[model samples]
Target: MVHLSHKFSTIPINFIPKQFSKHLPQQIPSQTTPPFIPFSQRQNQRSLLESQLISALNCCTSLTQIQQIHARILRKGFEQCCYVLTKLIRILTKMEIPMDSYAKLVFNQVENPNPFLCTALIRGYCLQGHVKESVFVYSEMRKKNVLPISFTFSALFKACGVVNDVDLGRQIHGQTILIGGFGFGFDLFVKNSLIEMYVKLGFLGCGRKVFDELPGRDLISWTELIVGYVKAGDMESAGELFSELPKKDMVAWTAMVTGYAQNAKPREALEFFERMLNEGVETDKVTLVGVISACAQLGAAKYVNWIRDTVENLGFSPTRCVVVGSALIHMYSKCGSVEDAYKAFKVMEEKNVFSYSSMIAGFAMHGYAYAALELFHEMVKIGIKPNKVTFIGVLTACSHSRMVEQGRQIFESMEEKFGISPGVDHYSCMVDLLGRAGCLEEALNLAETMPLEPNGGVWGALLGACRTYSNPDIAQIAANHLFELEPNAIGNYILLSNIYASAGQWNDVLMVRKMMRERGLRKNPGCSWLETKKGVIQEFFSGDMSHPRYGEMKQVLEDLLNRLKAIGYQPNMNSIAYDVSDEEERRILITHSEKLALAFGLLDINADFPIRIMKNIRMCEDCHSFLCAVSQITRRVIIVRDNLRFHHFHDGKCSCGNFW
Candidate 1:
């Protein structure tokens, strides 16, 4: 019963192709082994005899050799020695060369059950993901009156961490304290494990308490605290403690880098990564993951190529390419380079669930619903197990494409077929689905019946639905909830005011405006940006006059409006509060942020190239209709990413099919 550490596979369970075994060696070793020492006089030959037998046993790591050894030992009648059995376990456990032949054979036959043998078996079970079996074996060992030593308890605790079972882990903690003293002044191992468990479980207070109790600690103890703080979402404290450490191991360095990235300080994460490299410390998968995650968050596309080059140059055989590829895809996607993302996604040798999740998200972000759906199908074709995050990406695609049937199919399949219960994010996707497709009632019903309490995102999605269909009733209910939950969020206030204005409820709109002013909240002005041929981006806000080309941009806008009007386009002023005069409505429409940005594109770029615009909020109904008319008149495609879906305007219509 030789126990080995866990080998983490990047691919998910079901997604690991049938060809997985090809990565392993074909030959396997047997569990039974023979003694090399001849049976003779007792004490005189013991030392030399044991050494020779151990040398012979060491060669039996393979199933073939072990079976031969077993036959020879049984013929010699020396197979009953417990010491011989323990040595066999060691050989079997460490047979990393090929088949897990030892593991298979040992569990099938053990003459006498020993604590050491049980520990070895438990380690194998934990590595193989038989978490419950690991716990069961430990409990059975206890019932048999075998009090596990320090090593056995540590291994059991590691199993608890893997499953993230807090209750089972707490039970393990109780057992440990019962065996040892509460005052960490005695030993560091117990305290360290306790702290790591508590931190991983989100009990930061308990982790700190355990750390404080430690009388004398090593660097490993300090590393555990840093890791705990990082995992607990307290990056500031993690940074402080990490900088103060006299000796920093690779684990501590990576932990601090990962913490910064997770807490939205990717720039700092990257800076520290460089400093750590400069310090000439060893790097591993955790270090690489932290760097890749930081790159993703910072939209640092330049780092992707550098990482690829470095991995190749250093000849590193990484099991983490899947995680890296996923991060690279997300980085390109966030940086608005769909081409780069698609290329990175295609080159991955082994695609995991996260790999698919990232690319699908990239496509959806860029408004490539068709491309997103195709990639998703390809993910399924390759046997990746789709999880909740994967479905979020898929549902988002259907939402953007306004594919009502496909969206509904995925939403239902989460629990009905996949056995995955919907969380808040899943419900949010559904709301976006029905909201974009104009099925307001169904979307509202789904939100109201959400298994978990509806959060601000869920309510906000429903409010977006109400705004889409001009349904004031659902809008009011959602608005009230959102205000109570997140009164400081600027978007909700704007949504409520816009809904009021859309329905010709001038008094309500004015009241909402007054409330915002009283609360010292102001609407975020509409703004947009365009990527120029020069590779620089120019930003424009509503009523902006700071650009050097503002005069020329305004002239181009006026001329375009005149041409659009000539081509039989009339402005829709319905979204304007009916309480306002008609002249004021026309003037207000001219001052839209998107219009200001589009005028600059018209003045600078050729008519043949499509004018792409990204906005911070959903386009008003009037603006959508107006953009359609402008597209028809100018004979140019207009692609706008508003707060909702992508609007591809051409031939006098939008890609949303009048849904958005």
Candidate 2:
């Protein structure tokens, strides 16, 4: 609601004479001019003076300076000159000065304002968020029969978009058609602006209509629509349009890459990026960011190395590019390499909130709570404001490390000290922290009494904690709400079922399973990824022993199991949620996706390399214990990144200390 014009009110206004005095000659010649200077010479002198005044206006840094220039223009007998006045208005607009306060007064003095001058005023008002005032100016211009130029319509459309006034935008669109004779109706620039407006207002259909009607569309026209579809989460439509675009530019290609990346289609994003590179399309930091995001989502060490090499070959150093560095930090973290993430963070010459947050979250993901908290404090000490995501990382660190009091104090400080109100996500983090710390009642009470309504994440966190702590009572309460809020979220049902199974409540487990069956919801199959020594990423699924190296993989698991059992490592059968016999449970535990991935890693990956596995679900207690025992028996480091967080096992201990 703050007006830009109000900020300049303190400057004193000096009134200049609107016309020459009656006592003086109607026209004053230049200094030392002959008594009867020729008319052509006088005209030349005026043109030169206009150019000089315009140049001065262009260099003006303040409204007072522009006002002084205006006085000079009036004294030089160019008061009605639209050329200089239009330039003056544009300068004032660029300075963000209020249009009505000074520009309107100067415009009123002009006997016949030109189209460009009016357009400048219109754009200035629009830019200052005065859409109605700009529209009024447009109406008055029409009343005077001042046919709007293409720029005028473009400015209006842009303004309407800013204010989200679709009705006004359509009215202006009608004006373009009604006043079509001036050739402004079919102006390419105006059409593109219209498309941009519709897209910004979430009127993609209207934008497409404008695009379809274009007599001759250019790259900007196509790019605008492509980006519009991308924003709408319609990547299929965006791809179809992109495929039809005869002349693909980097902007259009990047739109597709970024669109796929944002829509969680990372593989498609990378494929498109690869195609773009093959086609020799130029890449900038923006394109690199999309590719980096895609790689981060894949969370494969192979892609990590590929991206790092690609960036190096392209001469894009992380130390110089904050965007690339921040993304690398996240990618490294997700790929189970917090050490590499920290290295990337340390080498960055410039760090923003994103870079700091990514690094903190990376540390938190690896269960390096002290390191995450220390970096957060460093970020704050250096004057970088922590956003909600940063606090999420901080709270997650506390949640994982059981730092309850610190988490509580920081959650309280979020609103009181930082002025950031606790949103539902923050509340969820608090619930997670308290629940993970075994205060199930307190976590439930907090979720119920939160100022904002508790969302699925809040209840889901409590449910997950219930599974961890074997609390079926609290699990049922959280699951009931989750069932209503996210009816199709199979994970909630699975968690509730697991909690029941762990508590020996077979009836309740069966009931939850029946609910899932009735709703036709199936649990997501567990999948895991591991990169081999040759840098090929391999995928495995739970209970699927169809690998070409199935014999070797099974033999490796058997050998490790035998070695683990010698040291008193027994399988945690409670991990299974179904009603199965002991033999079936043992078979199911041995065929887990992560266990298979670990076996594959041992068989193919170099001995010196840490066995890194990425899973699509939480690691079960049995698998977790097996990995710990394997790491100790073999004296090898095994890192597993699950949906929740990273677990680095070495010397018979996990980074999470079995707290997870």
Candidate 3:
């Protein structure tokens, strides 16, 4: 008898009708004398074999196992069964096997392929990022007079979204409208997939147009457009859609919360989270992460215990959820408790790259350089790959601590040892490290000669270093680049003017002021936030005594100034960037937002607890010195987080060792 395998390849299976005899063998072996089973028994045995083959395909965990099952299908003469073949194609896609290597071959062997079978192959190609191949497959299906299913369009649109092929997406989108039956068959799944595609491709207007045209919109459709608005930085549009959404689910609620958190609107995030809770929407790990991230940005100690408790109450342990643990580590660190951040890091049963990076970043941000480096070494020992973010944390630790040599070695070893090429961010860290170490010339050299095109961060780092060392010449060069790169960034102009003023270059300072005026740029008023013992947040702006306790705060500031002056703390007159009298400069320096926050903190914060202040701008030299003296005089630890890094003052010294 002819080999059974060869016979199976030519047999007409379930998908192929008997009239489609071109794929069938020309002759069949007849068994006249053999004792044969009944026709019902033979059919039953074939069905049983088909069921067993499908079950085996489902249980297959490896490519080799799948190949064995495919061989078994051929032996059973069921290779062309559309149902079984579709399942095989889906399994191959799930296993991430390349469609070209196996699925395509299986599809080509089938005769009179069904719509579902063709769509499965198209979906397989789409899953493997072969969009062109999927489109080709669609064309072939159309040529074969096979009507595409709903999932076919969904898969194609999703592929378009993945590759950001908006042009092809538009083509497919147009087909959905032009093709009569297919357009009517375009259900919620296809519509939502189209919305997601347009949104992800940065075509929010198109996405909205699709949303408006949909006969009925679901939660996914609304959420996709809302998230698109948020990503485009148009929160107002996002809010309008969000308000218009009738039935909200947890995913929709989480999108709003996450949008606010990502846009740096922490208060709005918390408010949305509260609203989500009040509406009785269920909370998941994603929702909690959004809330936790907002709390981290706030850096308020009062929210720390509450958020931690909420996470535990929801049965999402920081120790169990690495994301929660990472967010907690960041929260505690920003809240001025590096110890608590470490505790969270220690209890994490499963530590990934994120956990290690967050903990190290927390240590670095808190100026715990030794701790950051130790953790980094431990991460390497445990074989977790150090990504760009991890290296950023390591370099930040070195920069803040003035570990110039150590930082340099690591910077050099980035591409060579760790296989992580230094990005613009890493170069920014180097500029900061060298600049902080008083290596102005070297930092400037590195900034000018680096392989990558420097971004705002690189120029900003150089400008910051210039401010630290009072190098007006280098600051001007950095400022010129910054002015072109970030014309509207008032901080860059302010920093440049400050550097010039520090060197008593009044003419240059006036020129900077003129440029600011010509560009219609106004100085960003410095603001500081302080959380009181009663958990009420108070804000202080430079030279603004608008607080309800302004009178008491003024008196407190005056007393502290007197006490600070008595201890030989003279105001650094150069801190004022304006061309003014020395005495007037002293008057202006004392009214800075940080000083105002410090006074209010001393007044309201309890004696046992450390005072925490958050500032919108970097503290001036005079304020830094003033806080050091105040910390020594009051015998209290003061933690101040500025625009850049944290300053922990205790007994007349800062945790940064005065390098920052």
Clashing residue pairs, backbone N/CA/C < 3 A, model 1: 1-89, 2-89, 2-93, 28-63, 29-62, 29-63, 30-62, 30-63, 34-69
lDDT (Cα, tens digit) per residue for candidate 2, span 1-660:
333233434333233222222212334465775688699998887777777777667677877677656666766667788998899889988998888788887787776887888898998899999999899989988888888898899999999999899999999999999988877668899999999999999999999999998999999999999999999999999999999999999999999999999887888999999999999999988888899988887777778888899987788899888988998999888888788999999999999999999999999889888999999999989999999999999999998898999999889888888888888888898899998899999999999898898989899899988987999999999999999999988878877887888899988888988887788886577898887887788999998989999899999999989887887888876666555788888888999999999989888877898998888788877898899989998888999888888899998999887866
Q: For each candidate, what is the lDDT?
A: 0.71, 0.86, 0.85
Error of 1 at 331 (Å): 3.2
Each prediction's TM-score against the native? 0.64, 0.81, 0.86
Instruction: Please give the lDDT score for candidate 2.
Output: 0.86
Which portions of model 3 miss their true places by more than 4 Å? 1-49, 75-82, 108-118, 139-146, 184-186, 412-418, 440-452, 562-588, 658-660
> Can you tell me which runs of candidate 1 are displaced by over 4 Å?
1-148, 151-186, 212-224, 231-233, 247-250, 276-321, 347-354, 378-385, 410-424, 449-457, 480-488, 510-660
Clashing pairs in 2: none
What is the C-alpha lDDT profile of model 3 across 1-660, one tens digit per residue?
Answer: 234356335533443333322323334435477567899997886676667667778777887667666765785567789988898999999999999888888888887789899999999899889999999999998898888777889899989989989999999987777674656434788889888899999998998888998888888899999999989888788989999999988888899999999898889999999898888889998889889988887877777788899899878999989988888888888877889999999999999999999999999998888889999999889899889999999999999989999999889988999888899999999999999999999998999999999999999988988987888999999999999999999888877887888899988888988887788886678888989898877888997867788788788877878998887888776566545787777667777998888888888888799989988777778889989998998998899998788999999998877755
> TM-score for model 2?
0.81
lDDT of 1 by residue, 616-640 (tens): 6667777888788878877888878
**Best-fitting candidate, measured by lDDT?**
2
